[model samples]
Target: MTVVRAKLGAHLHSMTAPFLFVGSGLSRRYIGTEDWEGLLRKFAALTPRPYEFYRTSAEGDLPAVASKIAEAFYDIWWDSDDFSSSRKKWAGSMEGRESALKVEIAKYLSVPPALTGLANRESLEIEILKKAVIDGVITTNYDSLLA
Candidate 1:
């Protein structure tokens, strides 16, 4: 979150405050969300094929690999006890066989992580940003941390 403080001040205006554009890094710093590849790797573990298989099959295209992984998870999600509650909650959104992977991803991200690991610098950054005069917060991330 140090970037929040640093960048917010750079474009301040007297008439109108600046809007902070937070990319995908906030979760990585605050909650340690893995990068896209690593995130898919976690889900890949549930499938019969290894993550490397998906990587090779997709020819290094992460989105393609994600889709393939989602296809794999669709088969597992319908029968796995691990996703029983998820199946009940998301049966509507699944559209018969799709979006189960997204449901799993949302479930994983929605669980709050422990904040005890916050460093002194990050704490100070939070304090500084709390007092920052800004028009609003914007983030590429889908989480509601700023919203």
Candidate 2:
């Protein structure tokens, strides 16, 4: 890990404000968000089938399982009154569609992680990162944690 970090640090130092490629692991460490499979499994609980079934059926292909979950979840979302608020909110845009999965993901990630009351090195790191002289930011993260 140290070697990887050192190499990446050297690479970043070479470029003038190079775009940083942040991934899920960074969010997992900083904010306690689940990894991809764990996130898929969490949504799978709302589907007709268990998470394991989707995993096995998809041959452990997580994206495939995610598609399956999306399809099943759409049915539930459209037919249930519990999601009426979702429907009303997203009406005329993505209503009566499988896009509820996107909304669910957004809602799941919208909550910012609590970083207060931290008199620690990591908090100092965050402060430094906030003042970092990067050209811009790029991330695969779905949340607005850095925004």
Model 2 lDDT at residue 141:
86
Q: Ten-residue segment with the worst summed lDDT in candidate 1?
A: 138-147
lDDT of 2 at 83: 81
Please report the TM-score between candidate 1 and the true structure.
0.81
Q: Give the lDDT of residue 102 in candidate 1.
A: 86
lDDT of 1 at 48: 97
The C-alpha stretches of model 1 lying farther than 4 A from their native spots are 1-12
Write model 1 residue lDDT over 1-54, tens digit each, in one string.
Answer: 889876776655335877887766876786677768878999999999999999
The whole-model C-alpha lDDT of candidate 1 against the native structure comes to 0.80
TM-score of candidate 2 versus the correct structure, residues matched by position:
0.78
Model 2: ten consecutive residues of lowest lDDT: 90-99
**Model 2 deviation from the true structure expressed as Cα RMSD, one decimal place:** 5.6
lDDT for each residue of candidate 2 in 26-143, tens digit (9 for 90 to 100): 6776667887888888989988889999889889987888888888889887788978887788856884445887788777888887777555886887788778787777788886
RMSD values for the candidates in order, in angstroms, are 6.2, 5.6
Displacement of residue 31 (Cα, Å) in model 2 is 1.5
Tell me, by lDDT, which candidate is best: 1
